[model samples]
Target: MIYRNKTEAYWEPLLTIARDELGIHSFDPMGKPSADIRMCRVEDIGRALERAYDLGLMVGHTVTRAGCVNGECA
Candidate 1:
């Protein structure tokens, strides 16, 4: 599925949390697993989740916004 927000403003912060906070990096599927795809420990997931919550990205049980910036909410 296509992402609603493809801008760097939307993705950069999320990527920072994923790469800097969590051990898992390199979303590239074709890259080497050893260096590119690091396995995430349980603690890593917890830390990322906490960071996401603090950033107001994920609240309660919802995530997707009500409307899209391009007026293509569906």
Candidate 2:
């Protein structure tokens, strides 16, 4: 999810990432109340993070073990 910020300069790069990298063909602001956050699916989260990092954006993900559930370990 792209968090909304006051920097309008980031908008173009964000859109480019969403379209070219994230495979989002189109954007519809009317479909939602706010256009702040944009959520999309990418084939690989690691690749997405790399792309975002290259664009000077910081993206992070957390991994848990298979036996872990809701922060608890079996």
Best model per lDDT: 1
- CA lDDT for candidate 1: 0.63
Which residue pairs in candidate 2 collide? none
**Which runs in model 1 stand beyond 4 Å of their true positions?**
1-5, 31-37, 57-74
Candidate 1 C-alpha RMSD relative to the actual structure: 7.0
Residues 1-74, candidate 2, lDDT per residue (tens digit)? Answer: 33456357656665676667766544544456665355665565456666767666332222244336465555
* Model 2 whole-model lDDT (C-alpha atoms): 0.56
In candidate 1, how many Å is residue 52 off? 0.9
What are the per-residue Cα lDDT tens digits for candidate 1 across 1-74? 23455475547666778887785444445545556545678888889878877776454223445345456567
Best by TM-score: 1
